[model samples]
Target chain A: MRSHPHHHPAPDLLLAYAAGSLNEGASLLVATHLALCPHCRAEVTRLEEIGGALLEGTEQVAVGDDLLAGVLARLDEPARPLIRMPDVTPRPPPAGMPLLPQPLRSYIGGDLDRVRWRLTIPGLHEAAVPCRGGSVKMMRIRAGMGMPRHTHNGDELTLVLAGGFSDADGHYLRGDFAATDPSIDHRPVADADGDCICIAFTDAPLRLTGRFLRWLNPILRT
Target chain B: MADTTEVDRLNGLLLCVARQRDRQAFVALFNHFAPRLKSFLLRGGMDAGAAEETIQDVMVTVWRRAGDFDPSLAAASTWIFAIARNRRIDRLRRDRRPAFDPDDPALVPDPVDGAMEMMLVEERAALLHRAIRELPAEQAELLRMAYFEDKAHSAIAQERHLPLGTVKSRLRLALARLRKAMSGDTLGEQA
Candidate 1:
């Protein structure tokens, strides 16, 4: 477990998360962030209290006469665990700080060694994370590597897993969350000290806004 | 407003089931919460049959995971509501709800030590229940739509024909009021 993270999800995102209204990709990002940020987890806990209140206050419709009996009958049967065990290897992650947190680690199917990274360009590698409703991708940028300038066609949420990255908005270190929208267009470069690994959730493919990459955007669709 | 006694009673029953695996205690809990869970799931648009099935599943989970519930961290109602919410998400949506696994090594520990902080959280739950009830009608209604209907704020804004910012601000205002109400009591105790 790491220390409290400096960057956090926006209130609306956090609220949606607490409400259980966010899609899978977004929820994954928030859950991973929540693992690292106690403040947000507390906020979520409070909001969930509201959900509890609403559940209590809602009009009660008696369940079927047989429902309780049915439940009791099967109480002794083996049940699935609350948290699903994603198919993951037992191998420990690489030495030092873990790049992928729990939930995210399981979602990625295992540790960093298990990730099958493909080169998007020299010095930059990308891997698609399987999630429904939107796209999630993990990226690894070599030290001092700068991504092509781009703007989200829809909102993009990035959680820094290892090392750091900096863009027009600010520098994002491990566990820091950065949310970008179509309104913000800028290139992000990895900190010079180490390779930066981050997972990003995007509702829509990014539009490469860099002057040179602009023409290739149609073909890349990333 | 939730009666503290009633809340405590439910908490005790849950604890009994947790500690003794007492069938009688589980039965009492199932009776009380099953109806409420049914109502909650139906409100979210589940068909009657589906809601019933989900309630049974939820109740079974309640029985199984009773040991995991900590009264200091959450009220019984709040904990059950979360379980129902996650169950609903799984039943209704194609996407999985990714949740933090507490046992994961990468999981960050709460900043404050557990006991005191968790107790404060329980107190906050009671205050928030009342605070929600006390929110201006429109804000309360918006909160319901966001939660029960699982509608996005943007969707709420469109449905209400109001600016998205207006909807967000009202919700924010409602939350701020709740926090203020909760802090009022805590601050008094501290001073």
Candidate 2:
């Protein structure tokens, strides 16, 4: 019964997650957001079932020779049983830690202060996390600060962790999921409150479109 | 394609494996699921020997973890594929930074609960079959490439010579329609 973000991830992104086709970086963002949003988790589960249902209708292919024999040989000897999805990941990040979501805690090893933030611009900082498939960074923006107007070289998925931000489309609050592809043009500005913290994943670096800032695009390494 | 009786029988087989270390029941489960799992892995362009290896690994894991099965939470097919999918992910893992683990503990998918409400395979399969049948041919074909072939949207777009946005939106619409049907929030509900 926890409160959810007003802005949910696009159904297409969720579908990709359910299909297990999304890359690791984007998948990390989606998983982190999902830990906070029950509705999205339900949708993902529903999509998984739908995927399973689709599997039921597929024409079965014959297995290679020795498939059954090989499986039967291993009947007495089994490898370590799989650890189910829920068993390994710790849930409920204590009581007071509002800033750290479930997926981030393990990545940062539970120490929020240890995050190495690089000052990318005045009042804006970017901390890159090690992830596969793409660049995933945790971005912090001061209240009332606005990023340069921009589009993207690839898709970008940003999951707001704390405070708020807004773009031409709409406002995004904690746990909100916002995804934009290369085709989208937006200038995001922080809300007039405390600073905003969000994790953003992009397959390709962001391209700043503003006249002066466009020159900074290559150095931004977004 | 799964009839009610077939689903019932498969359900019973899994239940037996759970209650007892029933090798015969295990064989039944293996026979039914292994070929499909192999085909699935192979179609994703995995080599035949590797696909066989993965399928064997999946079956072994299924037997090892059968005791955790709960009929109320998931159908036998759902549970089986959940494990298969996870195993597949394990094989596909690249790099070490841990991008995301769907197997993470707290992110358990919504398991359909309540014995009365559970139909396991039969009802869901039938509804899903009809739903797929009803999807626009493009969407249906895309769904097949995605769900079964395990192709990424980018690859699908490349293969079909379509824009990535079109692939995503079409999939979104197709899934929305199926979701409505699966939840029983159908067009009939308005009547």
Candidate 3:
């Protein structure tokens, strides 16, 4: 029973997460939030259990050949490292970045100051992290900073890593996920208390309506 | 309750692998899970070669990571399913496939907490199996597509030529009913 984000991801989104179908960026946020929310984690576990039960009773259309010989041969060959499942015990976040959650620390190496951020515009900076599926960027907005109004061409998933940001909807705090589709448009402004840092990913490019800021689009990774 | 013997047998196999690294235990685990894991991978849209290779890799992984298995936490099938899902994700990453995105809202290392006390392991498992068995045929087919086929609800709707909204609502209802059956509540609420 952990205190969770006021707004959680949709049920369908959670279902996709359980099925291992959600995109990576959204997965990152979901995983992070799941760490913060025990209830959702429990539900996901149940869904996974059901998935397992389904698999168990399913028709066992056995593989045509014996794979054990190949596996045993590999076992006999040598003890090589696995593809890259990181060690279970992850290192602690660097100083001044305690708010950065688990799995993110594993990926980005550490927290805010540890990451090398590039300035996309005054008071707004972003850094692109290497990932497989979508363009994942860590965005930073200084206190009271605002962004030009824009709409997405595809899905845009932004999870707040630190501080808070308020858009046309409401203020989003750390661990809150903001999922925007192509039909929605809004301007987001950082809270006055401190800088707002978020991990954002987009399947396709964002469609910026304001022309002056449009030229900077190339810098706006998502 | 019907397959209590099978349940204990699977648990015993995992225990043997964890305790002794017994190759015989490994054999049984592989024989039981590999085929089904392949089925899951195929549903997730892998060709035969990829599915076969992935399941082999998964078995080898199970043999190696068997120590991590705690039968007290989840059923053997549940643990194997997680392993298969992890392997599938890994394959997706290595092959640079379109579907292998690890960044979904799912929590990782979602180690099924032993805290829930959700009945006995076999009982809880039977509860889930029974619920899935009881779903309306159409809903059961949809569940098959969503979990086994690895198809997104939107994709399922498009493939079945149904409205996306209808697909979503039906899936939601199915999930809600399943949850009620398993945990005595429609788990995970809005705040």
Candidate 4:
């Protein structure tokens, strides 16, 4: 089994998520984090209650008389199929597939086995995860390989999916969430024990600062 | 009074709709929530017709999904608010709301005992309602903009002419205070 996360999303990010104000990529990152972290899940649940209270506190506007009847009229119509919540018991991953969580799994179209990896450098493999207003990509770094030193111009969020990585901030295990901005400049190296795989969400392209990798920035653009 | 009893009644009404397919109970649920939802959407800048259409969709989903409601897990209003929030996001072409499946196997199970946790959530719910109502006007306004305006923090900073850090800090402060208030009561009870 994968290890639990030690790091978490920031409070502001969590609040934005509970308020449903985050863009798709950020929201996707938070949702995946929530799936892995029960504490944040509880925090989000409480935050959502605040939304409920705000919703309840709104001044009531009398609906048109016809509105209720219209909704009621449709009650007897066939229920549209919903992508309802799954059952309570755990379901194993598809045979031979890596254990990928929901929302992320759905976004990726399958588990890690399905990823069509492109070799970005000698040891780094990346597969783009489609999202608007930002870039989401799954990265697979060979054990002991280090990413080029870089800083973000806009916001970037990374969730560790498997193995581990360590930078100046700290080591991140499966389910750890790291929120990085322009203020942070560090290079993360995959753990030597195994290949480190993670999904990264960035609103702007990262500015690579390594002497040799600087020119490779264009290839990294979302 | 909108106290715990009112909260329970709403939960019970939804359950009635779920178990018996009781139209009267559904009507009760709709009457209480629909008008509030309409006002909320309008405040969020949706047109009246669209708000009405969205409300129709939301209420219908509530009816169909009522069986899924577990008051111990979430209050009735909270459940409905999530539905409305998702529907609004969809109607607005605001970014897709990525959602985690609650029952996913990778999910870390809550470590606390279920019954004890439920009690705390119930207690927190009451405290949260009061805390929000009593919050200083500036903080309350920020919350409104975040929810009703559906603006990102950067957008809010731009519109309010506050620095981005200030917008983020104030929001963080507001939530921190609300959380402290909720947990304070629980701490006191334990003491």
TM-score of each: 0.91, 0.87, 0.84, 0.92
Q: Write the per-residue lDDT of candidate 4 for residues B59-170, one digit (tens) a residue.
A: 9999999999888777888999999888887778545788887766666666656443535445666777777887888888888788777779899999999998988888
For model 2, the DockQ equals 0.41
Clashing pairs in 4: none
Ranked candidates, highest DockQ first: 1, 4, 2, 3
Question: What would the TM-score be for candidate 4 when compared with the true structure?
Answer: 0.92
For B20-70, candidate 3 gives per-residue lDDT tens digits of 989888888888887888788988889998998988788877888789888
Give a tens-digit lDDT track for model 3, residues A9-46. Answer: 77887887777777666677677667656667777888
Write one digit per residue (lDDT tens) for candidate 2, span A119-190: 998989999887778898889999999988889988888998878899988999888889898889999999
Question: Which of 1 and 2 is ahead in DockQ?
Answer: 1
By DockQ thresholds, what CAPRI class is model 1? medium
Cα error, residue A73 of model 1, in Å, equals 2.3
Q: What share of the true interface contacts does candidate 3 keep?
A: 0.43
At residue A84, candidate 2 shows an lDDT of 28
User: What is the number of residue pairs that collide in model 2?
Assistant: 2
What ranking emerges by TM-score with the best candidate at the front? 4, 1, 2, 3
Q: Give the Å shift of residue B65 in candidate 1.
A: 1.2
Candidate 2 backbone collisions, by pair: A85-B103, A86-B105
What TM-score quantifies how close candidate 3 is to the native fold? 0.84
- Cα RMSD of all models vs. native, in order, equals 2.8, 4.0, 5.2, 3.3
For model 1, report DockQ.
0.66
**True lDDT of residue B6, candidate 1:** 70
